[model samples]
Target chain A: MKISAKEVQNVAELARLELDEALTAKLADQIGSILNYVDTLKKVDTTGVPPTNHALSLSNAFREDVVVPSPGTDKALANAPLKENGCFVVPKIVG
Target chain B: MTLYNLSIHDAAERLRKKEISSRELTLSVLERIAKTDTKVKAYITLNEDQALAQADQADQAISKGIARPLTGIPLSIKDLICTQGLLTTCASKILENFVPTYDATVIEKLKAQGAVILGKVNMDEFAMGSTTEHSGFKITANPWNLDHTPGGSSGGSAASVAADMCLGSLGSDTGGSIRQPASHCSVVGLKPTYGRVSRYGLVAFASSLDQIGPLTKNVKDCALMMNAIAGYDPKDSTSVNECVPDFTATLTQSIKGKKIGIPREYFSTEGIDPDVKNSIDQALDTLKSLGAQCVDISLPHTPYAVAAYYVIAPSEASSNLARFDGVKYGIRDMEQTELVDMYKKSRSRGFGLEVQRRIIIGTYALSSGYYDAYYKKASQVRTLIIRDFKAAFESCDILISPVSPSPASIIGQHSEDPLKMYLSDIFTISANMAGIPGLSVPCGFNQMGLPVGLHLMGRHFDEATLLNVAHCFESATDFHTKRPSL
Candidate 1:
């Protein structure tokens, strides 16, 4: 339950965040305390209890494959920070 | 009485009778906001021109005899709910200018009924924190005492109604966001059963727990808002296919012989302020005097709720917020040429400290080795919490408790202490974890005059009982009538 700064940095990296040393230390302490508190869940006997993924009991909701009108390319792309002809422009991935 | 202070029911009746014009009502509210919002900082954005234009259209509709129940009612929408052509910042800088192309389903329904949208109100950044202190903008002050914090992340919505800046407001409750603030501001806030109101356009925080509901001047207005916004929508897969009831129909029903459960665990929880306990006990006594049966109940798993919720909510939040990678929408770091670097730079800069911390915690919890220990264990505890509510409801028609362990804390009280702030939600989070309808109505004020809220929670999809019980108590007391002398 004791989250170290190294582990916090690793998790931050996995979460696609860049944390400085100060923030990493703070997060380690805070997250460590939070996790320590959450560790109380271990004391409860959840024997034979199924994990609840959702508040309500719901199943896979299916619909007909009928095509509906989209928001159209322009409106959909309105909030995009950068855009190409019609698609979102992001930093290139492939060489 | 000032036009701004008129309840939605009274305002609608007057509007229909042609006694008061929608423009007059809207202008009065706008003027009130202009006069008081500087001190309260309740609104993030005020739509003055558009609100006046809508009021004119509503007047035209009334003249044509096409006015609906909420025809000219001015509503302050929480910033988390998307409104087309309006900035829907989740009080975060990342979405400061990210106007949605479409309105949230609730907004669509309100617009169809000719509801006048006054503006978007402030909330915690991405609805994460309890106080509006976490907002990228200004901290929203509790209308009762400007120096005190309005319990949030729906602080602005609650403050607006308390200050008479708007008749009613819509707010999203993930974990006590609506109810806690409503309690602090001495307003009525209802968090309907999950999926009762469509979450199609609500900004995702914790999907399983987040529910949008109303913050209003009274119980009747809360019910009226429910009628406007509650229904199924195909756009949100989780939206239930159940029939939306006339939420106001049962308000007049008697609560005689109704079983009101007082959870022993809730009262026994550590750190419950003495004034809050006294106020809640007095409210229970009032219910008993109204010929209601008060029963003692135990939800043993109540203590584990906050811990479980933090894990489950943040874990889901990590996945939900992963969509905000600065590519499709929101801000992007243009300087980075590499995709990975761009993602890191954009997310690190785009998200606030609390958000980043949550992402890291969630990521760590859901990571390979820790999943079973943290995420899975917490989820199992969530099941136990839900079962506790199920058992408690079997013996009671409705459960009553304090909305928060304490009344509104002073500003900066929990600003530096994350764990302390998280504990403020202990009394309100279980209802969400159980997916039941929860309402917070102003019960009484503490010695300092900070309002205390009486929490009423009922079985899933049974908001009628909760509203009816709250309405009955509200009728018996004048707590809801007391206004901040702002």
Candidate 2:
């Protein structure tokens, strides 16, 4: 299926990526080509096969709940570009 | 001995005999890196002071008679591994200055074993590309031929070891990140079965397919790394709890009657280079001479690997990488008038174009209108690919093939076409899809004098068997001894 310019913009918006007008057209062409190429999966018969979300056969490996003071709030926030009041600050979501 | 050339086994042995201090060895590798990395561009970050301090402590430990498999072995870590107080960028602009607060589980184990941390090696951004060209910082050139690309996203790890810039390095193999480079660079690289190593601090590219293993110069060193890093990790919910065998213990076993599989599917016409085919044939001949029962088998769904991988890996990556939004870690723009704008601006400014393309494509695939048609359908095909291996393995002890379809391509050959770039992982991704063990050992060099990696695959969590097969092959061949002409 051809990816419309509108769809490209939607995906770009959803992915939170900034795109110039040139890039938007290039992305449309590239993604359009990719989608066209990837359509080969449509030919395979996978009626009885169960989808594989996890590659390993095992399940339910969990760490016990225990308090560990590691990479505390300060350390976690250290990589953030902007912060305020011990929290990552961002632009207003609500008007 | 050059620190870059010494295997972990040899380094540890020499250190125990007091032949060389860890400080001396660490400095040697550091100096080697200093001299060559200007052209190779293998290392992204080097901790000279910290490395020397660790080496001194390891020397002290050895002086006091402390013993461990990795002690006093200075190894490079792939940039993907988290190093506390050091940048772990995944070689992407997105997390350019993001220093992880905690060490990856492998890092912790290496430190505990007294292994010297030489530095972090470069790779394709987020382990997404087969060639290191996808990296945002700079393309890592192959040690064998600077004009050719180093296969990646573990290209730096493989190239560094190949050039003797570092003795060994840890690399994640979601789809041949470790093995392909090892093939291109003529080194030994292993991808332990999925869940063989913990993923707690690894910036997850794909949860299911990702497994961290060492890229080393020889099989014995790969075994040493497998032993230390192959245990169950409670931190990662998917970490397998099966017992990790002392992988190095079976190094001397014979390979007389092991049923080695040669899948005709691999040799079939998907553009297998003649040199690779010759090397694989030579490899099979050597194994046959050593008493291996070779048989033909089929993994008919082999063509589906790239398609399924692109869908599943990117789908998972889209989810895993979502946490990198500027708000929590890395770069976040404050000047945005709205929160959504802040996120878009940060990610757009941070991630490279290829990474953005993937994130966009992944988000599109997993979106509400297309989830069932794309992500869900691709996943079902992934199951068929897994079953193909499962059936084939039942008829053979281990399967062997070429690590890559072609030898290392020249830099910028396929960097422009993402689909073409993704096909480079064709021969290796199926192993990851099946969550089985995969290894790449230098088989021979092409007419270009570049290397060709022979791939050995085994059943799930069967690194021991794979190592035994590799050891058997190495004992019979001198490919491991061949290094780039520096």
Q: Going through the candidates in order, what fraction of the true interface contacts does each contain?
A: 0.92, 0.83
lDDT of 2 by residue, B1-486 (tens): 455678778888888999988888988888888888998999888888999999999988888998688887888888989999988889988788888888999999999998888888899998888889888798899999999988888999999999998788899999999999989999899998888788888888888899899999999999998888888887888888889889988877999899999888788947888888898999999999989999999989887778878888888888888887788777777678877778888888888888888888888999998998889898999899888888998999999989998999999898678887887788899988889989998889999998999999999888898899899889889988987776
Going through the candidates in the order shown, the clash numbers are 0, 0
Write down the lDDT of every candidate, Cα atoms only.
0.93, 0.87
Q: Write the per-residue lDDT of candidate 2 for residues A1-95, one digit (tens) a residue.
A: 69987898988887778888888888888888877766778888999888998887665555658887676678868877777888877777776
CAPRI grade of model 1: high
Mind giving the per-residue lDDT tens digits that candidate 1 earns over B1-486? 479999999999999999999999999999999899999998999888999999999999999999998999999999999999998999988787798999999999999999999999998899998878889888999999999989899999999999999999999999999999999999999999998999989999999999999999999999999999999899999999998889999998989999999899888888889999999989999999989999999999988999999999899999999998888888888999999889999888888988888898899889999999889998899898888888888999999989999888889989778988898899899988989989999999999999999999999999999999999999999998888998
True contacts kept of 1: 0.92
After superposing candidate 2 on the true structure, give the runs of residues whose Cα lies further than 4 Å from its correct spot: A62-70, B1-3
| Residue A19 displacement in candidate 1 (angstroms) | 0.9
The most accurate candidate by DockQ is 1
Query: What is candidate 1's DockQ?
Result: 0.89
